[model samples]
Target: MNKKPNILLIYTGGTIGMIRDFKTGALKAFDFKNLLEKIPELQLLDCNIDTVSFNEPIDSSNMKPEYWVQMAEIIEDNYTLFDGFVILHGSDTMSYSASALSFMLENLAKPVIFTGSQLPIGDLRTDAKENLITSIQIASKQENHKPLIKEVCLYFEYKLYRGNRTTKINAEHFQAFASLNYPDLAESGVHLKINKEYLFRSSLNKNLIVRKNLDSNIAIIKIFPGISPQVFQSIFNIKNLKAVIIETYGAGNCTTEAWFINLITQTIKKGIHIINITQCSGGSVIMGHYETSRELIKAGVISGKDITTEAAIAKTMYLLGQNISGKSFKTIYETSLRGEIT
Candidate 1:
């Protein structure tokens, strides 16, 4: 007889956890301890569900590294007890948290699915029920007695995306995120379909390792026409800055102006690693592909190559926390580990 999967639902706060009061029309947190009463559909799944909520639920805008650490700790503490985890988080910072967690949890052998909805769970036409239900189902999915997904992923609307590869592109629509460079791991429709070819394969021999320390001394500089030297110099002057992400033009092209080139070169020389990513939504950064980008290559800027800004920031923090030397930081940034970059 097959044992039903045990899935843990971590409610970290968001629209999906909200229930509207009919009398006041104000939304408030719904206790997940009684989740089955709120969403009876959960009873249909052949899985044992458990719930954990933050002591104090926070708005997504208030999300920080400390919250991420807490989430990781929860997963690590319950790593062996649960077959999978489904995180209910706000859409605003969901991508960032998901991306950071992807790097923090190493050698993951079970699914960690993040999801949220656009409306309160109590609303008659709310999307919360479906999003939450599907997320839990995906987390519990198994084949041949082995978990199908073994990585951190975001299941929003109807698509499953590599957590680090996703970016929140919509504020009001049901589809809140898009993985521009990578393909979807699964798509829900009349039937729940898994794109097995796109799913990450994990090594059964390696145990999951959680990284708790994250260096937050990083900044992003989006290059723009008519950007002044003073503005550029100010960002480079941030005291004790560890890394900077330069959002460049097409294919990582930036101003070939002497002042801009010299500024970046000087920053690189100062041991501040600069990563050059394309500002375009869906394209890889090809350093030296054009005259405009030639000087960036000469200046020793690392190509971000289709990585979203959210993932780039998380990767920088993760690598910086490792205290890697300046000589190897560029190499690590350019390499793809969690499919964050092409």
Candidate 2:
């Protein structure tokens, strides 16, 4: 008989990690040591489950590069002991965290599934149970004694998405996340469905390389009808700013005004990488597709292609952390390293 996969459940704090106390009538952090007691269905999975909680769990809103490093360290330290990891996180910033992890855990050959819920674990109508249970199942799935999943992913509302491709699109609904530019990697329904073709596979021979030094010296500027030169000058003039992601209009199009083009050209000349990504959530940024975006192309703005803004930020930080040369930054950013861009 085959030995069951060992799964590590990391509770990083979120609505899913809270339970209602009947006596006090207030939500409190659920004791993950009693996880099996809270959700006995986990007992039915064909895996050995273990639990780890943050010393002081934090809301996803408070998640930062340091927290991401903590998560990566946990995975690195126990990588040999666990076949997979399932993180319980908040829905609000889950995509950002997930995207950051995808870049941090380089050459990852095991599943790192991030999941959360629109409701608390103790709620009568909680979606947490299903999400948590199915994520573990997906993570533990094996073929010929090897793990089935080989990359970081996000599981929510029965859909499995490539972590970096996902974005939180809804706050008040059960389906809080969406991967608009990419197809679902897997789905959970009557039977858990794995779209094998869509899955990201890594080489087995290479060891996992954890990237801890993520540079957060980046800013995002969204173009609006009346965005002034003063506003643009202030942002570009920020001290030690490494990169800026411009959320331009449709297909990476922006104003053709001389001042706007000159500012972007000057910024790129000063060694600060300027990335052009579309403001629309569902489409790729086709730079220079129209006359409006031509100046951006001429000014040497790197195109983000189909990358989500969250992923763009994470990717930029990760690349900058590597001390990638200014000459190679644009070339590398336009290339998809973690399948983040199509």
lDDT of each: 0.91, 0.94
Write down the TM-score of every candidate: 0.99, 0.99
Tell me the spans in candidate 2 whose CA falls farther than 4 Å from its real position: none
Best by lDDT: 2
- 10 residues in a row with least lDDT, candidate 2: 198-207
For model 2, how does the per-residue alpha-carbon lDDT over 228-278 read when each residue is reduced to its tens digit? 999889999999999999999889898889999999999999999999999
Stretches of candidate 1 above 4 Å error? none
Model 2: colliding residue pairs:
none
